[model samples]
Target: MASDTTNGTRTIKITGKEAMLKNKSYFKTSTGDEAGCAPKKGVVTSKIKGKVYYTAWSMDVKFEGENVVRHMDLMTHNHASMPGNTPTWPYLDEMAVSKEEGPCKDDIKKEKEACKEFTPHKADGPSPCPPDGKPSTKDEADAYADKTAAKECLRARRCQLSPYAPTGKQPGCCPGQTGHHVVEAGSFYNVGRGGSNSTAIEGTANYNADKAPCICVEGCNQYHGTHGLMHTYQSTAALNSGATTQALPLEGGKQTSVVSLTYKQAKTFGVDAVGKSFPESKCEPACLEAQLDAYHNKQGIDDSTQCRSIATGYKGDEAEKAANAAVVARSSRLAAASASAPSGR
Candidate 1:
């Protein structure tokens, strides 16, 4: 006798012999060709009386003549909710049985070897290095020097400035030694003692200055090297002659919306004529507040819900204008209402 649980609630108790005889109708139909059962030879159905029961089958057993040997669990879809209450095809039960074993040791080793040899695709080509040769401006040279120093600092085993590194006093191996220090302006170390006191130079040396000539170190502070000095002189001459001032193109130029520009870009446009060409460079809320204050003596309306709604609802020039209009309309309405209303006193 065997007891089977269908759908985790109902328990079915029936003998193997009784189940076979009761569900004899399903036995003929349940095969590999008809119901997608694994083995074509075995009887998959287990029923008691007219109702279906669960039967276990195994792959180890094979059929021989009249003596039919069923192996593994012959799982079937339970139609307990159906009107007829007949069990569906024995496909679900077959999935319970495991097929292949886990991957062997050799297979894992081969995967590791393949992964080691694999080269990832690079969309931007080789790694980025700081700008080489001398930069035209002191700003550019300073920028290059900082970037190169940061890169070298990152490559070293220990970086004093890095938050991830161990805290407290620690010596670093990089040149321009003043213990381990982060590369930045105003960082100084003792050079020599003068008049019974120590003299300190407020700068560090550029480690890869030859390879990366734009790297401005302590020595290049006065002129940022010969190339930088030449560029500085040339830039000054150009500026004096109005050569540096580039007029915005009036026609046959690309038209882009100003709303796409960042807050800083918009602010730059407001302050500098160079950004005036971009029509879409409208200022955000803070700038809008300043504009409202200047035009209407209003400061609080820019950050209000109504103003924000109007701003977001419209785009580009329309957004700024609409927001301003809404603020004005609201203020007018409030003023008119206050004037008409009777005094409470």
Candidate 2:
């Protein structure tokens, strides 16, 4: 049994089964009156040995005409109230009481008028402030001029290699030529001469007046001849000597400026040349060796002797053919061994 002595005057006893059931109607008035029942106020409970026990109360209340029951926690002061039969029965008394006085009508009207006086006005037109101006420095002006000139050049399909001239050079103009030429070999022919036709070729090279072999021997063929002819000659030389594209420094502080190609480019050129010169797939080993040499040369590796030996041992397509033959021989041997082996009955 649990006893709720909330007001210290009225005591309501609730059994263990009733507490378990928690029937809210048990606390209502049994007389069937118009106002709903009011349960004992602030009924605090605890559970001991699986049975609910009433402990204490925080609020005091009397069962009146239309008041509903409310419980408030003694420690936390949290309030809870039961539902009422009338729509506003629980808040009727509070609603009937006078509320705190608000601002008067005249005061409200005066406040609105004051707010209206200070309100911001919308602008009649766009801002009177001017837009930001461009930079005025010489460098900025020059850059803008360059950009405009580049755009003009691009529109005209011209090359803007030098920024000094607004109207840039033509698409295929040589260094000193006004018009495009089919071949630019005039510069290379006057390499070592000191007359009006002379042009300096930069880089270290030994020159002899008698033979005049320095320019060609130093491998400046690209500068001396057309690109297609030079490329063909470079491809042939690389295939002949398993040397990569790297330039080798000779004695007397001079370097051999060799024309170099990437591995894929070298392989393509070699394969094409081999197919034209020899039977189909007959010089594949040489082509592969050339590609390997190009790769090693590009990486600056120093294994020239070993690479040359390997290429020589398996020249042409001998390496690939030998590997295929070995595979076929192994297959035949395996088939023969399997045939001669004893079979289980």
Over the full model, what C-alpha lDDT does candidate 1 score relative to the true structure?
0.24
User: How high is the CA lDDT of each candidate model?
Assistant: 0.24, 0.24
What's the lDDT for residue 61 in model 1? Answer: 25
Model 1 lDDT per residue over 158-224, tens place = 1111111212211112232111111111111121211223222211122111111011131123344
Candidate with the greatest TM-score versus the true structure: 2
TM-scores of all predicted structures: 0.13, 0.15
Report the lDDT tens digits of candidate 2 across residue range 101-208: 221222222322332222111112222111322224433322322222122111121111111111211112122111211111121112223234433222112221
CA error at residue 333 for candidate 1, angstroms: 43
Clashing pairs in 1: 57-71, 57-72, 57-73, 58-71, 58-72, 75-93, 258-280, 258-281, 259-280
